[model samples]
Target: MIEDKNQQRTQLSDLGEFGLINHLTEHFEIKQSSTLKGVGDDAAVLKFENKKVVVTTDLLLEGVHFDLSYVPLKHLGYKAVVVNLSDVCAMNAQASQITVSIAVSNRFPLEALEDLYAGIQTAAKIYNVDLIGGDTTSSTTGLLISVTAIGEVEDEEVVYRDGARPNDLLVVSGDLGGAYMGLQVLEREKEVFKVNPNNQPDLEPYTYIVERQLKPEARKDIVQLLKDLKVKPTAMIDISDGLSSEIMHLCKASDVGCDLYEEKIPLDPQVISTCEEFNIDSTTIALNGGEDYELLMTISQDDYPKIKANPNLTVIGYMKASNEGMHLVTRADTRIPLKAQGWKNFND
Candidate 1:
């Protein structure tokens, strides 16, 4: 049993499925106008008026996608929502509502589930999204969370992976490699704890990166920033599967090639230092380390000046003709084929 003395631990069987759902979701109030009907329904009813609705779903498993030893249930719930919202934002839309479903083993108490919902509530409040509907069920193994996010955008404002054109500038929002390096630090600490269970890890130095891994926010601001700047991305995708893999996905979908500059890829100072401490290449980490939740997009040259001075965005490279192929130009001036080594659930 997980230790929590303040709250009384209750068994799942005591409340039953419907009772448990009501107890947990009682506080979640519908805040979106599009949500015509939310919880306590056979299915959620939504109305989008003249706007185009965007929907995305993601499933996170306990051992495969996350480690409970180092991860908090609240942070896990927030992340589960954010990852799906990131997908909706990738399409340049404003997320309005989310449906969360969880499968949990009997080992988790009602209090533990409350902690998880607390996180879900926090994220909903911060992102301004409503918890429209969801389901809860029993699991024999561990915890699994599935979130489906719904968003809205005008038909003209929506961006897709296939809309990029040749000569468009490749821009990325915020920094990279920090989340991947943060995972490395957490994994190392977990190993240390396994060997000596009493060891107290000084995680202060790795706080930024660790938080980047554990509690990443989607790039919702980038969408707003783009709108404010009156610039529309020709193509866009969120960096959930690492920079290299996501870039390749854009290229393939748009039928174009790219020249990603290794020197130009943004890296946080902590990521660089952590890479040195671990003797791992920072560029490789940036390329293959996924789950940053930042936005990667292509913009026409005409729109370049608008974003040129923006500190939150970085222009890393440019789209090329399909014949050029996708390659990364290293700091040494050597060109290598860009490769995708993003997260693979099957391999895990």
Candidate 2:
């Protein structure tokens, strides 16, 4: 019994980063001709009729990705789909189908699963995506959800992270940083609950911020709107890892640079107020907080008027020569170096 127990206790840390990736893929055999590529790029590339398809997945684990104390099951389910769809939209493709796999502890009853699935179905209908298949499993700990979304686009219409050209205008849809600030509010409420178990947290005032955190919408409409307007993004990425980190990704992949205008960073008023309440810099939160699920893209300079004329888009900056580096021009008329403060799960 002792020997068996010892053999089962394999620490994940023993295989770090590349070691883990190699270990996970070691036994996986590519058995399908349709799987043109797998597991080694921004998105899995697949060859189809006369077009290409991209498939990507994301996993969310309770306690790590979310706290059940504040996150309702329904909202959690909706968010899982939203995050995966964001990745599909990042590649400038229409997300058509998704498979949702979930593992939950026995503590949750059938009704709880129904609540979760309700949100999933709602998202499917809203995004006009189909739910093909998935699996359910039992877990001894908290809940785990893994979602794989499949999308397709014509070969030429597929905008990738590596295609930004110099002189392209950088634009973002909606606002940033509200979700991060909303998280701060939820955490504070959780702390308060710990101190006074009977105190019902008054979160009525933080409706916008709370909603931003709990239920983020993927920019599917933006994709359709852009197409209707005849605007083709040179390169694109979803702002799931914060603006600064994503900008760096586009810059590195395109071998270009960016100069973002701080004054132009679209931020919600509630995010600004919440940042003030928490004594956090709104600009920093907007740049590094992540999880806004907004679209970040670069368009040709000639298309600037198209984006400018439309109220839905904001021109934050533009791509430049690689040697220029990424800089943020503040409203104070000062230029500051942009830094990527993306979240590191290892620190947790």
Candidate 3:
């Protein structure tokens, strides 16, 4: 995130609020037919006559949610949108539109915001979600982004965290631990840069994990894949706050206990190798390392056959009676109580 000494700087106050909004949102095209009125209005207009709608909002602060030291504005913009879309995907819904509101300090220039909006537009186009409406205002803080994602789902197709039942098979989309390890790599490089500014980081070996942290994609495909396979999840939640934390959330909401097999938790080769390099336990990283953005779900045993061969999904474990309690069935055949030690918003 190095800045050029001679780079052009167009002041935000010069364009004014309305001019800035219009300039930033001018290039965003409406992709969803449901979006009747997009940017330029006080509030967005959307229509979903028969289908059920799902709305999710996420607020990302400058220092709290992201550190601009290593996080690019464009990547931050894209990540802000994807995080909310991941929430929609967890509901088994099709994301149709999003309203992005940003608050920035006086130090930011118009071109910097253009780069941020460029990432937002790229995400909107790739996800096929329309940019509806939002508010922009001056902030004393660095930068804050709040994205509200709206999605559509069939009335009966909508899944919740409480639909899981005893004996249901636990499933997860894609591998874990990469994002957390990637963050470790970035944080290390950031520290290194402080000590030696001219020493360039050799991140070639950590490309996969690094990308997993910087440009993670929401598992929107898993929802459609389940529909195509005629497999409806009994319960669903996206893996944002780590696997153990999300599993506990699902289990508590469903009034059931889970046996998350340690052996079954998917770990990419890069994640495993990096964990060893860091001298950190891979299993612990998989359990507590947050922001995977993969979908975690439960399905009936009857539906297992349909997804058994699919490479996109991995059957991790099974649900049990609530009295049995949530636990991790270790590789050594030992059972231990599962704990929620992932991301805490109010942590001091």
Instruction: Assess every candidate by TM-score.
Output: 0.98, 0.85, 0.98
Candidate 3 displacement at residue 229 in angstroms:
0.8
Instruction: Report the alpha-carbon TM-score of model 1 versus the true structure.
Output: 0.98
lDDT of each: 0.93, 0.83, 0.93
Q: Write the per-residue lDDT of candidate 3 for residues 210-329, one digit (tens) a residue.
A: 988988899989988999999999999999989999999999999999899999999999999999999999999999998999999999999989999999999999999999999999
- Compared with the true structure, the alpha-carbon lDDT of candidate 3 equals 0.93
Worst 10 residues of 2 by lDDT: 1-10
Per-residue error for 27 in candidate 2, Å, reads 36
The segments of candidate 3 whose C-alpha lies over 4 angstroms from its true place after superposition are 1-6
lDDT of 1 by residue, 1-348 (tens): 112454677899999999999999999988999999988989999999999999899999999999888888899889999999999999999999999999999999998899899999999999999998999999999999999999999989999999999999999999998898999999999899889877888889898899999999999999999999999999999999899999999999999999999999999998999999999999999999999999999999999999999999999999999989999999999999999985677775
> Model 2, range 232-348, lDDT digits (tens) per residue?
999999999899999999999999999999999999888888888889999999899999999999999888777788877899999999999999999998889889987789897
How many clashes show up per model? Answer: 0, 0, 0
- lDDT score, candidate 3, position 318: 99
State the lDDT at 181 in candidate 2: 85
